[model samples]
Structures are given as C-alpha cells and as structure tokens.
Target: MNHNLFGIIVVFAAAAAWGMSGIFVTLIIDSSGCSSVALAFWRDFTTFCVLLLYTLVTAPHRLTIQKKDILWFLAMGCCLGGFHIFYNKSVMMNGAAVTTVQQAAMPAVVTIAAWYLWKEALTREKIVAMVIIFSGTVMASGLNLFTLERINVTGLMVGFIVPFFYAGWTLCGKNIVNRYGAVPCLAIAFGIAATMLLPLQPFVTQPGFLNCKIILIFSGLIGLSTVGAFTFYMIGLKYVQAGIASILVMSEILFAGVYAWFLLNERLSFVQTIGAIFVIIGVAWLSFKKPDAASE
Candidate 1:
C-alpha cells in the first residue's frame, strides 16, 4: 500500500475509535455517577495495563526507553491527561457546546506548532481544509461559533486550556512516535497519564471506581478504544504532518454523531447533516491529494 494512503486509513480508523468514546463515557457516567477525572483515570490505567501486558508478551524490546526520551514521555502524558481534566471540566461547567467550539481551534494551533517544531509547511490546501473542518465541526455539533455564551472564569480558562494541551499532545506524539514507534511510546505516555490522573481522584468526587458493572464494562471499552485510537493516530503521524493529522482527527466529531445516532437514538439536524458533508469533503481533500500537491 502507498504510505500516505496507509496513514490516511490508520488515522481515520483512530478517529472512528475515538468517536465511540462519547457513547462509552456517557454510559459510564449514567451508570456510575463518576466524575470525568475518575473515568479518565480508569480508562488510562486500564489502557496502560493492557498495553504493558501486550508489550511484555509480543515485543518486550519495545518496552525499553532512552533516558533523553523520558521527559518527552512525561510531557506527552501530562498534555493528554490535562486535556481530559480540563475539557471534561469545561463541559461540566460551560456545557458541551462551549467546549466543543473551543476545541475547533485546535487545527490552527497545531498547524503553527508543527511548522515551528517540525518545519511542516502551512500549505494553502491544508489551511482551507482546516477552516472547513472546524466550521463543519461547529455546525455538526449544533453550535453557533460566533454566538457562544459567556462562560465563567473557570470554564473560560479550562475551555481554552483543553485545546492548548490537545495541540501539545498531538505535536509531542508526532516527535515521540518518530523516535520510539507507536505502541511503546503510547504505553509510556498512557502509563504516565494514568499515573497523573490517579492521585487526582481525591481532589475530584469519584464514586464509581469498580463498584458498578456497567461502568466497569464501559471503562474497559474506553481503555481498549483509547489504545486503538492513539496507536493508529501515532502510526499515521509517522506519515502525515502534525497539522494535517489534526485536521483529519476532526472527523471524530462526525463519527461521534454517527455513534450517537446508533447508540443513543439521537438524530442529526439538517444543518448538522450539511456539516458532516463538509467534514467529509475536507478530509477527502487532504487524503486524496498528492503528497506534493499541497506543497508550496
């Protein structure tokens, strides 16, 4: 298979997996009444354990990490963990609309970061696709990007913070994946993410833990889905630029809508349908164009 095509397939698969997270997370929250931090802790911890076991059995050599990479691992892990913490809080405080709108800015941030850190070019096609994708994400989520409500100080801060860390995580993972490959690097990142969330349980209200069967099952799915999503994303990062990868991942919004319709009986609005179409167009434009086609 062509390398870029493979990366496109892999990243789209990751988006699909991540798209299911909302359903699983909703189930856990409904059944367990757990805080988002607690849910994230369980999800990352389970992911770490499963990946660790797999590494030990299939590729123990991948488990080894260089000394210089330790800090990167920690930073990547914290960025991811912080995204969950802040984004969840933003949703709880400001409503999902606000947070989702905030997240739409991620591609732009990532584009600049990738250019600075990795010298990835900010091509015309990429910039246009990013704008379309972000616009579609807002429309698909039934949000008015320009008419967003005023959030309180806490919500506002965390709302912005969520995408900052998410952008950091994406670019950081791009570098880490190039150096250590996907699975082992993910193992280390998730291990650190799980560790970071573990101690925060006290600060947050966590009732579920292992007490609820539905929460347990959903939490397990979150872990496995996370592993699948991040692994595929990192694999794709090896081929795609961080900026393009971020735009591709925006497909998660559309996928989440699909999953919601399938599992939660939620129906998409007409505008949302149009928004989904726009997202498809944006992603396809990026995926099918020649490698140098978007280059300046």
Candidate 2:
C-alpha cells in the first residue's frame, strides 16, 4: 500500500512536469529560432542520453532488447516520436493556452478509441461527460470551434496529434509493457526514436542547435520533465490504482493553464476556459469507468 502511494505521487509529479514542458519549450524556441526537426532532435537526444546513462549504470546487464520487440519498439518509437515532435511544433505555432486545450482534449480521443476499436463498454455517464466536455470546449474556443482563426488548420492538425498519437501510444504501451517490461521497453523505444532523428540535425538546424545555453535548457527538459518526472510517474503507477493515477494527471491541465496565464503572459478567453473545464470533467468521467467490452 505504501509503495502504491509512492507511485501515485510519482505519476502526479510527472503530470505536472509534463505540463511545464510546453512552457519551457516555448521559451527555448523563442530564444533559438530552430525548426521543429532540429528542436525535436535535441530534445530526444537529451532524453536518450539520460535514459541511456541510467540503464547503463544501473542495469547494464539487463538492457537487452529482444529481437522481436525491437521492431515493435521501433514502430512504437516512431509514433511516439512523431507525437512529441508534433506536439512541440504545435506549441511553436499556436500559443500555450490552445495547446493546453488541445491536450486537454486527449481523454476524449482515448475513450473513443478504446470504445470503438477495443470494444470497451461506455456507460451513459461517460457519454454524457464527453458531451458536456465537447459543448464546454466549443463554448470556450469562442470563434466557431471549427473555424480557422488564430489557430490555422496546420497548427490545428498538429495540435490534435498530441492526443491522437498519445492515445495510440497508450495502447501500444500496454502491449510493450506486457511483452518486454516497461523500463527496458521505454528505454528501447526512446533509443529508436532518438536514432530516428540523428540524421536531420544538420539539414534543418540553425544557430540554436549549437547554442550551449539552449542545450542546457533542453537537457533540463530531459532531466526534470522526461527522465525524473516520468520515473516518478512509472513508479507511482505501479502502486496506485490506474483510475486514481488518471485522475491525478488532471493536474496537468490545471498546471498548464496557471503557468501559461501567469508566467507566459497568455490569456484564456471565456470560451477556452469553458472548453478546459469540459475537458477536465469529461476526462474525469471517462478515466473512472471500468473497461467492459473494450478489452476482451
């Protein structure tokens, strides 16, 4: 029981750290002016080094990647990698407030995916929650939710990918964890994803890629947000109930809104506030339900 409590604490901390990543990345980009490719490469590279160092020092003997799971890991890594690149890119294009809204929309996607593809049963309460969330967010976005305004179609598409691919990652993560154990699997996946970006740094990068200061900032991302925070989350999840873990992560949206509004000087429109509220409520409902028809 104590172990479980620790895990939940880790997960909550990871959620908050993740929420801050956007604001951090935004500051980095404002200083660096690098393309998404370069920015992504450095980001993943820093994380790779952190994961690699930990694995080498602590579990050098245990770091073998199964030949079978190698391919699976690679594929998952690509999807996961793409998700990060696109999510960060979205923040670069859209402001943090909107990015937060878009991410807040993820539970809807995960629930929908689980229901339709996994055949998970959805309760009436869950459906109502989704509806309320959608209505509220639409109200928050103000200028017709579907219309192109400050957030263009390209940015919109990229922003949406954050949840879409994360939902996909969540699905893939279950299989990988079942097969290879989470730590090594996550490590391998990060390895493959990092390798996927090594070739493009020169072709797409500018002065920022070489900036020592930017490099340090990027490493801060890996250290605090990715490695340390995620480690806490993974540990916490092992002890706490998954439903509780999901609920605890609701803090990300809250954190993001506070950080953006207070630190980043971003303003949230009434519509966006409504949308954010809906997203929180919807996710709370969806994450709490038991999977019946979803995963037989």
Candidate 3:
C-alpha cells in the first residue's frame, strides 16, 4: 500500500486498540480492585519497562539525546501524565462511553495547534470532516440529553480538559519523534510519566486484592495495548497531518461503543449504530485519495 493508506491503517488500528482500553481498565479494576490512579501508574510503569527493554535491545543509539532536549521530554511526559490522570478520573466519574465522546474535542484542538504551530493549512474539507467526525462520535457514544441527572459535574469538567492535554501530547510528540525517533521518545516519555505518578501512590488508594498473577496479566495486557497504540500513532503522525490524524482517531468512539455493548452488556441503540456508520464515512472521506493532489 501507499504512504497515505498505510498511515490511515496504522492510525485506525491504534484507535481500535485505544477503544479497547476502557474494557481492559474495567477488567483490571473489577478483577484486581485497583483504584484508577493506581492503574494509571501501573499502566505507565508497565509500558515504560517494556518499551525501555525494546529500545535498548532493538536500537540503543536512538535513546541518546542532547542535554537541552531533556526539558522537552519532561514536558511531553507531563502532558502524557496529565492526560491519563484526568482521563481516568473522567472515566470513573462519567463512564467510559461519555468520557471517550468528550475526547472528540482533540481534533479541534489539534487543528488549531497545527495551524498556529506548524502552519498547516486549514482547508474547508478538513474542517467539515472534523465536524462530521465529532458529531458521529457524540452520536456513537449514546449520550442522552434527558439523563442530565446522571451526569457528574467534576467528570464533565475533567473530561472537557482531557483533549487539551491530549492535543499537547500529540503535537509535542510529533516534534520529538521527528528528532529522536518514535521508540526512544515514547520510552523516555513513559518513564518520566511513570516516575511522576509513582509519588501519588502515597495519596491514592491501593488495590483491594494484591494477587500477583492477576497483576502480572493485567500489566502485560495494558503494556501491550499501550505500546502498540503509541507506536502506531507515532508512525501515522509521521506521514499524516496532525489535524486529520486526530479526526481519524474519532473512530475510537465507535470501537469503544461496540466493545462496551459486547463486553459490558451495555445496550447499543439504533442511533449509536447510525453514528458509527457516520464516523466510518467521515474517516473514509478524509483518508480518500485526492486525484489532483496525487498527480501534483
């Protein structure tokens, strides 16, 4: 396949993995009885350990960075940390479906950042695709306006903020990967984020069950999912514009809905099914090849 096609596939696969994240999270919590903050720490710590070994064995040279770049790594790490912290809190408060829908805002944030930071063109087509995707995500999330009583205020506030940190992480990640390569950048970022979160263990609640077998299995699952997702995302980011990439990622909502319906026995309404179709259409439209542009 061509570059664009490959990038689209990689990004969509990453989104699918992320869509399953909520399921794994629920499993780790329900089976292991771990708090969300603790899970966040374990997720990052597991990812950091696996990626570190992979980096060392596969490409140790990529790990080298100038002293000046340390701060950028730290900032990226903080961004990643903030995204996870707020996102887990949102998931706990608002439910995974609603929080994932709220993250649809990442596309808009990415578009604005791409325009201002990278001088990427803001074409009408891109804008329309973003809107379509956002609408589809909202629809796919099965959000009921009538059930306002079920909504948590803190969750809504934190959910709204997640996209900002997510956007920051993606934009900064694109830059870092361009310079230091994806694996090394991800390794360092995960390490720093895990370190930052480790201190919170004192303040956060611990897991009720401390089964070693369960913890190891959950850690492996989370580590594999995170590593694959981040690696694919970085690869796709290399070949695609940040804004369009972000829009394509809205497919996660559809995937998440499907997973919830199957795994959690959650109802998938007709409206949500229609929303999933719209999301697929929008992603395909955005990823479609432009004949004239291709010829140029």
Candidate 4:
C-alpha cells in the first residue's frame, strides 16, 4: 500500500475512534453515576500515564523541555482540562451528535482568533466560512428561534463554549508543539490537567465508583479515543498534507453522528441534518483556501 493511503486510512480510523468518545462517556455516566468532572479527570490521568510511559521508554529525550516553556504547557493543560470537562458535560447534556456538530465551528473560531491576535488576514473566504459555520452550529444544536421549548439553551451555550477551549489549546500549543514534538507536549499537558483535576475527583465521596464496567469504559476512552486517536493522527500528518488532513479529520463529526444514532438512539431532525452538511461544507472550504499569509 502507498504510504499516503495508509496514512489516510489511519487518520480515518483515528477519527472513528474519537467519534466513539461520546458513547463511552454516556455509558460511563450511566453505569457508574460519575460526574463529568470525574470522568474528565480519570480520562486525562490514565491517558497521561500511558503516554508518559510510552515516551519514557521509546524516546525519553522528547520529554525534556526547557523551563521557559513551562508556561506554554500550563496554558495547554488548562485549555485541555477545560475542554474535556466541557466536552463531557456537553455530551451528557445535549448528546453526542449535537455536541460534535456544534464543535465543528472550532476551525472558524481558531481562524478568527489567529486573525485577531497574530494579524493573520481575514480573507473573504474565511469570513464566509465563519458565517456558515456559526449558522450551522445554531441549527445543529436545534436552536429554533420560534420554538423556545425545542431549544436546549443551556446545552447550546455549553456546546458553543467548547470551540473556544479547543481553539485555546490549538493556539497555545502552536509553537510549543514544534519545540517539543506532539506526543511529549500532549503527555505533559495531560499530566498537568490530571494534576489540576485530582482534587476534584470523587473517589472519596463516591463509593464503589471503580467497578468492572466503568474501568473497561475508561480503558476504551483513554486508550482508544485519547491516546490512540492522537497518536494515529500525528503519524498520519507525516504522510498527508495539512489541508487534506484537516478535511479528512472532519470524518470525526460524521462518525460521531453515526455512533450516536445507532448506539444511543439519537436522531437529528431534517433541519439539523442540513445544518450538519453546512458545517462540513464550510470547514472543507476553509481547509481548501490558502492562508492569506505564508507565515500563518
């Protein structure tokens, strides 16, 4: 098989694995009665442990970072920790399909932030894409203007915030990722996030929280979705162009919708389905358009 083709396949597999994250969260919450925060903590802690071990054994040099980069790692950790907490909560509140579709606005958010912060030009294509993405996010979230009851206002709000947290990490890790490599940066960030959330863990208050089923669910979440997804996606990036990889990664949203529909019996209205299509189109458009500046 061609190397690029193999990379594409691995990336798609990673996206599919990531798509299953919401299902795992739902199952864990249902089976263990764990709060979103607890789940986020355990997920980060376990993923960190695994990645730390892998890096330590295979490439210990990757783990060495200058002390000056600590702040960047801290910012990444905060963003990552916040992302997991909000993402899990959004899944719990609004279900996976809605949350993932809403999250499709992340590229737009990051683009706008880059324009604002780093003077990256906001091209006509980007502006149009952002408009489409935001509109689609509203629709995908089932936010009907006329029908108040059909709208989950809180869930929509929570879901909307997800992209900002996502963008935060993306921006923060931009340079740091180059400095220390993706896996090590991620491992450190996850470790920091786990440390931050350790105090909030409910192990002391919630008895029998560590059951067989929950442990298995956590294993899948941490092993497959967190570690496996990131590792495979990084490897895929080596073989695939960034633009193509960005477009391909949108498969995560579709995979999430399919998983939610079949596994959780979640259904999208016709309008919501159209909204999801809009998101895909907008993000793909953005991916195809060249950046205004080469530096960007």
Candidate 5:
C-alpha cells in the first residue's frame, strides 16, 4: 500500500475513535451521574497512566526533560485541561453534534493565532476560510440573533470558547513536541492536567460512580478515544503532509454527527447541517492553500 494512503486510513480511523468520545461521555454521565470535572480527571489520569507505561517500556529516556521546558509543558497541560472541562461541559449542554461542529473552528483559531504570534502570513485565502468557519460555527450553534430561538446561550458561548484552548494546546506543544517527541510530551501534559484536576477525585468515590457500566465506558473512552486516537494520529503524521492530515482529521466532525444522530438521537437543524458543510469546505480550503514564502 502507498504510504500516504496508509496514513490517510490511520488518521481517518483516529478521527472515528475520537468521534465516539462524546457518546461515551454522555453514557457515563447518564449512568453514573458523574460531573464533567470528574470525567475529565479520570480520562486524563487513565490516558496519562497508559502513555506513561508505554513510554517506560518503549523509550524510557524520553521521559527525561530539561527544567527550562517545564513551563512550556505546564502551559500545554493547562490548555488541555481547560479544553477538557469546557468541551465536556458544552457536550453535556448542547449534545454531541453541535459541540463537535463548534470544535471544527479549531483550525481557524490556530491559523489566526499563528499569524498574530509568529508572523505567519495572513493571506486572502486564510481570511476567507476563517470568515466561513466563524459564520458556520455561529449557524451550527443554532443562535438566531433575530429571535434567539433554540439557543442555549451559555452552551453556545462555551462551545465557541473551546477552540481557543485547543489552539493554545496546539501552539504550546509545537516547539516542545520536537524536543521530547509527541507521545512523551503528551504523556507529561496529560499527567499535569490530571494533577490539576485532582481535587475532583473525591467525586469518583460516590456511590454508583464506579459501577460496571461506567467502568466500561471509562475503559472505552480512555483506551480507544484518548490513547488509540492520539497514537494513530501521531503515526499518521509521520507518513502524510501536515495539511492533508488536517483535512483528514475533519472526519471527526462527520463521524461525531453520525454517532450522535444514531445513538443519541441528536439531530442538526437544516441550517446547522448547511453550516457544517460550510465549515468542512472552509477548513479544506485552508488546508489546500499554501501560505506564501514570506510566512514560511
């Protein structure tokens, strides 16, 4: 098989696994009455443990980090921690489909931030793509300025805010990822996030919180959604161009929408569906266009 084709397949599979995250989150919340914070904590903690063990076995030297890089990892971890809390909260309030569509704005956010912070080119194509992405996110959120019908204002706000933290996570890890490798950096970041959320650990001790159903959900969430998704994505990046990988990762939005519609009975409105299409088109446009030489 062609290496690029193989990478595309792996990345798509990773997206599919990530798409199931919301379903598992909803199921755990419904069955165990776990708070969003608790769920985030457990997810991070379990993923960290798994990644840590993998690092220990495969590349123990990667675990060592310079003291100077601690701050970078801390920032990355905090961004990831913030992302989890708000993302899960948004999912709880808005359901999976809407939240996932809102998350599609991440690439736009990252693009804008890069231009601002790193002097990356702010090209016409990227500007147009950002506009389309923002417009689509607003529509997908079901926020009608005229009537304000079918809108959860808080959820919409929270959902929209998710991309900022996600972008921050990406930006913060960009430099350090080269130094420490993706898995080790991610393992450390997850550990830091889990540590930050440790105060919520008591919630896990509540009656029925650790029941069989919730346990199973956690296992799937940690094993498939978190660990498996990241592992596949990192490997896929080794074989594919970053732009193509970004485009392929958009599959998560579609997969999440389908899973929500079938399993959770969450349906997107006509406008929302159109908005999702717009987001996909916009992000793909951005992915396909290369920045000018000045930016590179």
Candidate 6:
C-alpha cells in the first residue's frame, strides 16, 4: 500500500476508536451521573498513565526538561486540559450529539487559524470545502441557537469551547511535531494538563459530587481512548500525507453518530444531520488539497 494511504488508514482507524468514546462517556453519564469536574479529573489521570508509558517507550530521553519549551508546554497544556474539562462539561450540559457537532467544526477552526497564524494559503478547494462543511453544519444544525429552548442555548455555547481548544492543540501540535517529537510532546502535554486539573480531584471524593460508575467511565476514557487514540494519530500522520491523513480522520464524527444512536439512543434533528453531512464533506475536501492547492 502507498505510505500515504497506509498512514491515512491508520489515522482514521484511530479516529474510529476515538469515536466510540462518546458512547462510553454517555454510558457513564446516564448510569453513573458523573459531575463534570470529577469526570474531567479522572479522565486526565487516566490520560497521564497512558502518556507516561508512551514517553517511556518512544522518547524516554525527552523526560529531561527543555526549559525553553516550558512556556509553550504550559500553553499547550492549558489548551489541551481546558478542552477536556469543558468538553466533558458540554457532555453533561447539552448532551453528546450537540457537542459532537461542535467537535466536527474543529477543522474549520484550525483551517482559519492556519491561514492567519501560519500564513497558510486558502486555496479554492479549501474554501469550497470549508463552505460546504459550514453550510452542511448550518443546514443540519442551523445557526440559530434561539430555535432551541432556553435550556439548549447554554449547552450549545459551552459545546463550542471544545472546538476552540482543539484548534489550539492543532496549532500547538504543529509547532512541536518537528521539535519535541509527537510522543514526548503529547506525553508532556498530558502531564501538564493533568497537573492543571488536579485541583478538581476533590470533586471525585465527594459522593454527591460523583459516584462509582462515573469514575469507571472517566477511567475508561483516559485509559484507552484519550491517549491511545492520540498516539495512533501522531504515528499515522507521520506515514501519510498530511492532507489525506486529515480527511480520513473525519471518521470520528461518523463513528460518534453511530455509537450515539445505538448506545446512547440519541438522534440529531434533520437539520443537524444535514449539518453533519456538510461537515464531513467539507473536511474531506480539505484532506485531499495540498498546502499550495489550498492557498490558490
């Protein structure tokens, strides 16, 4: 198989595995009723273990401090930690389907950021893809947040925080991919993130604040999906062309929807479903286009 094809296949398979996290999270949410803080706290702890082992294997030497990158590491840690915290909160507040849509919008967030910050060219293909994805998202979900009752409004807004942080991680990841190496960078990133969330650990001990089932869910999320999936993404991205690697990763949303439907018994409205399609198509276009092709 072509290296690019192989890499993309790997990244997406990683994505599919990640897609199931929602189902797992939802299972805990419904059965265990985990508080957002507690859920995030436990999740990070699990992530810490995964990253610790990974770094030991790939870049044990990176264990030594790089003082220059401390600030950068802090920022990356904050972005990543913040995303996980708020994403779990979104899951608690608005339900997973809506948050899933917000996550789907990450490519748009990253694309625009790359254009402005990295001086990446926005080629016709990219423009079209983003537009289509945005249109699909809007068509499926509709931009009007007011349409949903007052209750949904907050959830939707919080859900958006997920993408914002994801965009941060994307750029931050790009910066470190060449310098720190993906495994060590991620391991360190998760370590910093874990420290950031440690204060929230108190929430885990209080019975009212959390329960066993929720802890189990959080444990599961951290153990396999969170770190393991990222490990796969970094490893696979190395083998594949960046473009194709990204497109295949869209499988996450697809996986989320399927899992949500069966496990969570959740469904999106017609417009939302349409929006999902648009997001998928738009992101797919982005995958095939090169940096130059996108700029043109």
Report the number of the highest-TM-score candidate.
3
Candidate 1, 165-280: lDDT as tens digits: 88988888888787777888888888999999888888876745566777565655655468888889999999877888888888888778887888779998999899889989
TM-scores for candidates 1 onward, in order: 0.90, 0.78, 0.92, 0.80, 0.81, 0.80
Deviating ranges (above 4 Å) for candidate 1: 94-98, 146-156, 209-212, 293-296
Candidate 5 residue lDDT tens string, 1-296: 76666766788888899989888888887787767788788788889999999899998899888998989899988888888988888988887756766776776666666667756666687667667766766676565657856668898899988878877776666547767777888899999999998987775533254488778888889899988987677666555544345445766766777777898698999997997787678766755565366523
| Candidate 5 ranges with C-alpha deviation above 4 Å | 1-14, 137-146, 203-209, 232-251, 265-272, 290-296
lDDT of 5 at 43: 83
Model 3: per-residue Cα lDDT over 178-213, one tens digit each: 777787899999898999899989888766546876
Residue-by-residue lDDT tens digits, candidate 2, 1-296: 34544554567688878877876787788888877767677666667777777777777765676676666677767866777788778888876656656765665665565556545455576557656655654555344666566667788778888877665555455445544455655676677777887777678755364778877777777777777665565555455433344445655765666667787697888767876787677656654555334231
Model 2 worst lDDT run, 10 consecutive residues: 287-296
- What lDDT does each candidate get? 0.79, 0.65, 0.81, 0.74, 0.75, 0.67
lDDT (10s digit) by residue, model 6, range 37-123: 665555665676777787798778876757776777778778888888778788777766567667767766766767677666655
Which pairs clash inside model 1?
Answer: none
Off by over 4 Å in 4: 1-15, 117-119, 137-145, 150-157, 202-210, 232-251, 265-268, 290-296
**Model 6 clash pairs?**
121-295, 122-294, 123-294, 123-295, 136-275, 137-275, 140-271, 140-272, 140-275, 141-271
- lDDT-best of 2 and 4: 4
Pitting candidate 1 against candidate 2, the one with the higher lDDT is: 1
RMSD in order of candidates: 2.5, 4.0, 2.4, 3.9, 3.6, 3.8
lDDT of 6 at 253: 68
Please report, as a residue range, the 10-residue window in candidate 6 with the lowest summed lDDT.
202-211
Which residue window of length 10 is worst by lDDT in model 1?
Answer: 287-296
Which regions in candidate 3 have their CA more than 4 angstroms from the true location?
A: 289-296
